[model samples]
Target: MSTATPQKFEFQAEIKQLLDIVIHSLYTEKEIFVRELVSNASDALEKLRHLQLTEKDVHDDNLPLEIAITTDDKAKTVTIQDFGLGMTREELIQNLGTIAHSGSKQFLKALGESGAKNSNLIGQFGVGFYSAFMVAKSVKVYSHSWRKDAPGHVWSSDGSGSYEIEEVDGQRRGAKIVVELKDECAEFAQDWKLKEILTRYSAFVGFPITLNGEKITTVQALWLRNKSEIKDEEYTEFYKFQAHAHDAPRYRLHFNADAPLTINALVFVPQENTEKLGFARLEPSVALYCRKVLIDAQPKDLLPEWLRFLKGVIDSEDLPLNISRETMQDKALLDKLGKVITKRFLKLLEEESAQRADAYNEFYAQFGIFLKEGAALDFTHKDQLVKLLRWESSLTEKGKTTSLADYVSRLKDGQKEIYYLVAPNREAIESGPYLEGFKARNLEVLFCYEAVDEYVFNNVREFDGKKFLSADHSDVKLEDVPQQGEALSEADVKDLTKWLKDALGAQVAEVKSSDRLVGSPALATNADKFASPMMRRMMKAMKKPGEADEPVKVNLEINPRHAVIKKLHALRAADADKAELVAEQLLDNALIAAGLLEDPSRMVARLNKLLESV
Candidate 1:
């Protein structure tokens, strides 16, 4: 029955070291061992399939090309069996007991050189059979090579630096690895647990996986299929299954790229932004896969941080991964992949915005904040992100929005800058003094309602060679508009400004006659080149109390043509104290309108004094 007694062999030093790492430190999760083993099984099966295509006289030529996994809790063993290519006795010794499959010596040198996790590099080296040691008290591999003349063999090891290879008979077509679970690792021997692992990491594998004789992987990898052959209903079903949601996807990008890198990506935008509905921020949802096996479900840097809401799969055949296949070894290659995906997504957004206006508006209303975040922080994509940004403007109808490209389309001759104002809402901005200057000069002012919008514009700085200027910034100097009514004289304007500056003291950086205002009495403008009052308030809210806030100084622009300014100029000489009180009240009113005033106590007290004086 037996050709010989089991031959014992001591592991090479590098093999021992690798075994130690596998059992002790290689994987972050012991469940990952399931993924690694299944991956190796899949590889073996793939090899057999290729051999069948070219070679004749292959053994078990008609065996089903699939993987079967069984768990026996009573026996405390987990078995992964594949009906593909197997190995002979000499093959088992070389592929398992020695350093051949492991590239053991070079791998240890790589770990030392990187001084960090490089499973991405390890993946390039090869899959380890030693991963069985991670959870096994003892392991046995029963294999029969694809060659008809090759004899079956069993490789057994306790993972204590030595293993035994013995000739065996009646073994089937491929390899079957049985791992007896260690005491603490017994959970892996349960059918339910093995099924869960398979569903997560191996569900998209090229072959069907039968867990305990029941097929578990039923969904095909939709991303890998051709778009022309796929149906709309099929896409929606895949979206529902992959995203675990009942709602249909708002948008789906199924694309394949070759230049720069080979990529197959299928990304979806959910119908609703959960974060917009007051849920916690989403984690990165684009799962990364190599061939068909998952590398990471939520690769943090797979896409820019702003794309956390994207759902689907990204598979690259070119990834150079480490042995564990858990991490990427080449950081530059990873970054290039991310950039390619991001650029393609932006292009998709641009197309949708142009061709599907209503659908895009709905998507943007829910998830535009993320685009704003990208415009602000992801400098590489900022220009593209800025072009996709939309906002309600002074020129648009009440609730309607316009894009930077559209806004620039209507730019008047020699209009060298794009002006915007940050306020709480459209009504607040339209009814406020900031719009008066832009309206009188026939210039459009974009209405930025969200606090994040200001930060976005500040980071974007310019679009289409036009600098973004805040309508209320002291630096803004619009063309003077002609006045129809009698206005205060130059001398009186100068006197009133000097008196108002003295009355307001440190509160007003300077008081000057307005060149832009048409209706409003006055306006307060922040002296900071880019920081709006609302932006400062937002910053202050995020900072600790003891943190130093940037000092604020503002300019007061008094409309010379306004009746209140005329009355105040004369009233100052007739009643200095009353005029001074009115000036202080006016200054406080302007500051409040600008979203600059923090505590209203002084303004409230001064109002009572002004009413008494009246």
Candidate 2:
């Protein structure tokens, strides 16, 4: 058998292109080649072990089911051997020498479409065995089939488009891939370097992997076992090992679902949000896996971008297991997986909030902004995300927060709107004029402290039949409270508004007596039927191109009950221009309170002019 001449075959054109990329551009990190070779070895071993149970007699049946590695730094070689199902002569030709027979053409087409970015998709394709060529000058595979009748073979390749398969006698079951390292890849032959790669990527392999005489893969695949059987310390240890995190998990969701897809997810919320402390924005660290092998270490689309703060593993057998993220051939399937996982995570948060209030609150305190972001951006999960939002309301004391559910529960019988005010802090919202009417009407207003709240509420629209209404909005009309010390007749109020409108000119859309204002002299309301004044200002700040620079035309709503209006009615009659300054000053102050004031320089000069008159 050793004298049998080698039969040679050329790789298909597309396979040649794939080989070139694998050797040059497919992987950014050279260490990954070690992972790919070992993963393939493990798969072969698993296949043979499965065959052993079904068949009464097997070739080399008693050989230990494990992977062994040996390094020869002086000889510049590394060998990975597995006692698993090996290849017969025909099997070697089909597996190692032929690519057109495999699905390599389709794989190459996908690579061309996605370009170089998604090389991470390689492992999913089951073609990872080729990755060894990246670090190798030449490769030789020695194998024997699990079938006692089958003869062993050796496949040799230099990755120059062709491979040779020859009969080799006295071969044990499974394959041993020997890589003669390229001059530049000599480091892979070092015992310490090879061990590091094996430990980092292949540590949890179901079968034991030994580097020389020392074992590297010792950690059990905890994600596959029942959660009840696992100890807390074990989970913590696995998380630390998987996520490379120093702090223990703040929250963990380890669940197995059979519906929609077969999934085993171990998701964790970190003990602290690093981004909240001014660190770099967290990348999508949730490593995706299939069975026990990793798919993508950080798949950006596996979960929504807003979930970047989470760290864990989501292993789904239902996933296609072999496709680029950008051109996920089964996009609908992937989307279904994403939706299911996101829904589960949201449900987990809801459960925590209900059963473990303080802990959930702590998590919300650190990660609430991400939830708000998802609410504003991901319409698919908008309604669910909105329910998850938490903030202090005008009725709640400092640091105390209420959810939309709680706010909606307390709404009055006829209250047709869910009121909210976006302010910098609790002090700002309380001191601002917007809350006065809501407070007087005994209606609860959600106090939104984040800058993005304005954008979020505008899109959230409503909850439970109550339309979202910003307390600062101009069109708000609260039920009138008992009039307090007001002496302005309707006729006097009409004349004052008409004159003020003429004086303010283009700045005022329509000046009228306010129904929403309780104590303020005047308030600026948005004239745009669709966008509020605050919305317009936000749009402007975003530097939306081609938008008009025309000043925001606001309807000036004046409170007839306020002492300032009572004085303003006489002041206008006594001194016209002096009254004009006070009118503009009152409008500017109202604008400032509404969080719409931009250029305050003119307001300062006008205030000084009013001071000179006094």
User: Candidate 2's residue-wise lDDT over 302-355, tens digit each?
Assistant: 788899988888887666533322134566676788888899999999898889
Give a tens-digit lDDT track for model 1, residues 1-614.
45769999998878888888877887788898888888888888888889888998888888899999999999999999998888887778777767675566666776766534333333321346677788899999988999899888888999998989988878888999999999999999988898888889987778878988999865788888899999989999989888998988988999998877879999999988899899999999999998778889989977999999999999987876656677576788888999998998999999999999888888899999999999999989988998888999989997789999999999999899999988888888888888887887789999988988878877888899999988899889887667767889999999899989999898888999988788878989988755587778777889997998766689999988899889999898899888888898888788888888877998898889888876
lDDT of 1 at 530: 55
Q: What TM value does model 1 have?
A: 0.94
Q: TM-score for all predictions?
A: 0.94, 0.86
Residue 544 displacement (Å), model 2: 9.1
Collision count for each candidate, in order: 10, 0
